[model samples]
Target: MFSIVVISNATMVPDEAAIIQQLFEDGLEVFHLRKPEADEQAVRLLIEAIPAVYHNRIAMHGFFHLMEEYKIHRWHFREEHRQETTKEEMMRLKNKGYTLSTSVHDLPTVQRLTSLFSYVFFSPVFDSISKHHYKGVAADDFYLEAEQKPVPVYALGGVDARNIRSAMAMNFDGAALLGTIWKEPANAVENFKLCKQNVQTY
Candidate 1:
């Protein structure tokens, strides 16, 4: 299946709990909770707001320890975070049956490392939608690397309905949207629908 993973806004979404629940109910595959600024308590509160049944579909980018108590089965570590985490520790986490995803900006890392992950986010497939001056890889460059894709690589930067087809055309396994999902509507749920539609139609 062409997967769709929705990432939380860097800060917080208005009525985020409601929006996330609606998206899950509406058939979102993965909801990546990525509040870089929030502490463990705040993260707990956010997770607590969602229905218990949907918790397993949620993945987090922070507070790894919370995964055990919260029973969160999926989590992602940025490349830098992964660097800080010892390989043995990461393996231990994997052995415990947690699905680990990570970020990779270089082609070689993907070739060498994707075997270790459930999936990986290959970013800036188009351009940066949120960060200032964050240059994205050219479409040709992306395609060149993507042609050798060994695992599920979710296009992460500047992904939206209009360009999701580009990701699919490049043979990406899925698209992980952030700016489009958070900035498009009164609630981000509409964009989630659009994203899922694009995944089907693109």
Candidate 2:
């Protein structure tokens, strides 16, 4: 299956929960909750606003304790956080049925983390839409085939409807959308739909 992962905006948006629920209803496979600035209570409220049925589809970037509370099994660790985690601890979490994921900037790191994470985000497949002055590698520069990687690799950063096909051509297992979806909150679902359509053709 072509995996379509939508990441939340760094800050809250109007009717965010409602928009999220709509995405889930529209067949969004996974949603990464990445509110780095929100406190536990704030995050809790947002999670509370979302239906419990969709909680399992959420990948919590922080406030992991809520996972147990909400019966969520997906967890995301940022690059630094993943580095600080001991192998034993990661294995412990895996043993308990956690679906782990993380981010990486290069292919070497992705190769090194093969077994530790269920999947990973390789960023800047194109220039970022949200962050300025961040450049992405040319698609031709990527040579690894999907079968070459130990774990599934998702292209992240600057992925949108126009270039999703390019990511798939580069042999990425999937793509993660951030700026493309949140750049205009009103178009989030439509943007996702377009990207999904592009990926489907691949």
Candidate 3:
């Protein structure tokens, strides 16, 4: 089965931690805690709201220092942060058992990725649902054989129940959901289950 990852809404949402905990309960294995506008204290409060048992399933996008207190071992770096992080720091994280990941927007970058990353998000596979006018490449142009990719790639933008199968058919290992899950926060769990069922039944 193709993996399905849920990315936290970029801004804080009401009952966000509770919603996330429900996602984990419903079999969400990977949750990216990506709140770009939030400060360390805000992020810390959010993390503190979630039960400790589910902490390990989360991948911290910023404020990585919280990982120490929460026992989170997964870390995801955006393109800029990935470029700024030195190899030595990454190695140290690796030695400490952190599972690292990063994002890319083009095929060349995907081909150039080092084995240091466990996986990477290749985004905007479809026009972004969350971000206005952030276009995705043509599906035909996006196709890259497994041999051409050095790291496992998960489709990141505009992914929802409707197009997850297409993403997998295009050779993506998985699809990550942001908009589809949070478009209507009240329906988050239902939307996720629908997306998961869509892939599983197809």
Model 1 TM-score? 0.92
For candidate 3, the per-residue lDDT at 192 reads 96
Q: Quantify all predictions' global Cα lDDT against the true fold.
A: 0.82, 0.89, 0.90
lDDT tens readout by residue for model 2, 86-125: 9999999999999999998887787788586888998888
Query: TM-scores of all models?
Result: 0.92, 0.96, 0.96
Superposed Cα deviation of residue 123, candidate 3 (Å): 1.1
Those runs of model 2 whose alpha carbons end farther than 4 Å from true positions after fitting are none
lDDT of 1 by residue, 26-95 (tens): 9988899999987778789999999889989999898878887878999798999987888788888889
RMSD of 3: 1.2
Note the clash tally of each candidate: 0, 0, 0
Write one digit per residue (lDDT tens) for candidate 3, span 1-202: 5889999998999999999999999999899999989888889999999899998899999898889889999999899999998999999988999999999988888898888898899977899988999998846555769787797899999988888878877888888999999989999999999989988887
Model 1, CA-based lDDT: 0.82
In Å, residue 101's CA in model 1 sits off its true spot by 0.4
